[model samples]
Target: MCSRDLKTPWIDLNTLMRGQRRVLLRHGERPYQLSITRRGRLILTAADQDTDTAAAAAPPGKARS
Candidate 1:
């Protein structure tokens, strides 16, 4: 199984396909979004507790189609 640092949230790249909306996981009672770009890059985002700008997790894999 893939494991991640508990210090940060993890989003699976394969799960984020273009034009989808779903909750991948939760952090401290808040949900995060997993999505893909038209270019097929996977994305992970969480609301920054200190600001409106979303805090993004690192992409999980090497850029691949």
Candidate 2:
């Protein structure tokens, strides 16, 4: 591996979260949620990809009957 590839990639949580309570991260076909809990701690967990994607794909204030 090149020396550049050996370096660790890192970012500050505050910069990443950016005042948001949660952010969705995609890993290939899978989706994961990164969130700040009420206690100010971080949590990472698998999200329901199908449901989340569908909801996001939906238009604002629109719903399927």
Candidate 3:
């Protein structure tokens, strides 16, 4: 829901997340992690490089938080 005179590109979660709770995005050598919270909120953070950098949508792990 945007109201502006200028134009902007937007991507839906269904298309972006692709039915998963988490997805890894890469820009240059940096890795970004996008996650869906338990409250149905969105969070984007720098991902750990030591882990997998496959840039795939992964099934959410057990997070009671």
lDDT of each residue in 15-51, candidate 3, tens digit only: 9877778888888998888889788998888877754
- Write down the worst ten-residue block by lDDT for model 1: 51-60
List ranges where model 3 is wrong by over 4 Å: 1-6, 53-65
The most accurate candidate by lDDT is: 3
TM-score of each: 0.34, 0.61, 0.69
lDDT of each: 0.46, 0.66, 0.72
Better of 2 and 3 by TM-score: 3
- Model 3 scores a TM of 0.69
**Residue 54 deviation, candidate 3, in Å?**
7.8
Model 2 — TM-score against the truth? 0.61
lDDT of 2 by residue, 1-65 (tens): 44666467868998886666676778899888776766788778786845464443343334523
lDDT of model 3 at position 14: 89
User: Each candidate: how many clashes?
Assistant: 0, 0, 0
Candidate 1 lDDT over residue span 1-65, tens digit each: 36666877665544443334322445777766555555765466763344221223334432312
In the order shown, what is each candidate's alpha-carbon RMSD?
A: 10.7, 7.8, 4.2
Please identify model 2 stretches exceeding 4 Å from their true place.
1-6, 51-65
